[model samples]
Target: MTASRSSTRSPSVKVAEVSPSAASCLNVLILPLAIFNWYGGTWIRNELEVVVVVVVVVVVVVVVVVVVVVIIIVVMMIITIIIKNHNYAFIINRVPLYSA
Candidate 1:
């Protein structure tokens, strides 16, 4: 069984619905656009690769450093509160009872 697909596609083609010739013209133009994109992309990729990599590495390092600093600050804050509470408790317990 030989199945030949329809040259004209479904009604889902919006450009063809607007103008019949426009869709065919658009199809013809795709090859040049694709070629330009391929070459342009390679040029951009080569020039930007180092900058992109450096920016990504710097961002990652900054995030890690910030997270570590935040964690250290939180731990120190918790320790400080615990120590203050302990000292307060000890001082309170040591006070002598006064007669009214």
Candidate 2:
């Protein structure tokens, strides 16, 4: 198998590829979104918006998954307990005694 160029790129080479002004922000993928608008302002705005949207989506998905898992576990446990105790009764039958 051939080695990938980008994955094999050195740290210094990757650093040199990006401009000094674009070094920060940690939003390298945002550059393509603002390709039409080369000005830094539009890029920064679009980048922030995309990051926020992605983060919110991820958080919502995680919460939904956790809730679903908890519900499933609780349901399973309840079913197991009911089946195990199905033969048992909560009330005992007793005959009334006559008064003297």
**Per-residue lDDT tens digits of candidate 1, residues 34-99?**
576687743434535544654676699899999999999999999999987775776777787885
Clashes of 2: 0
Kindly list the per-residue Cα lDDT of model 2 for residues 12-81, writing each as its tens digit. Answer: 6544376666555435545454664575445446546777755676699899999999999999999999
Model 1 lDDT, residue 86, Cα = 72
Q: What lDDT does each candidate get? A: 0.66, 0.66
What are the runs in model 2 whose C-alpha is more than 4 Å off? 1-45, 88-100
Each candidate's clash count: 0, 0
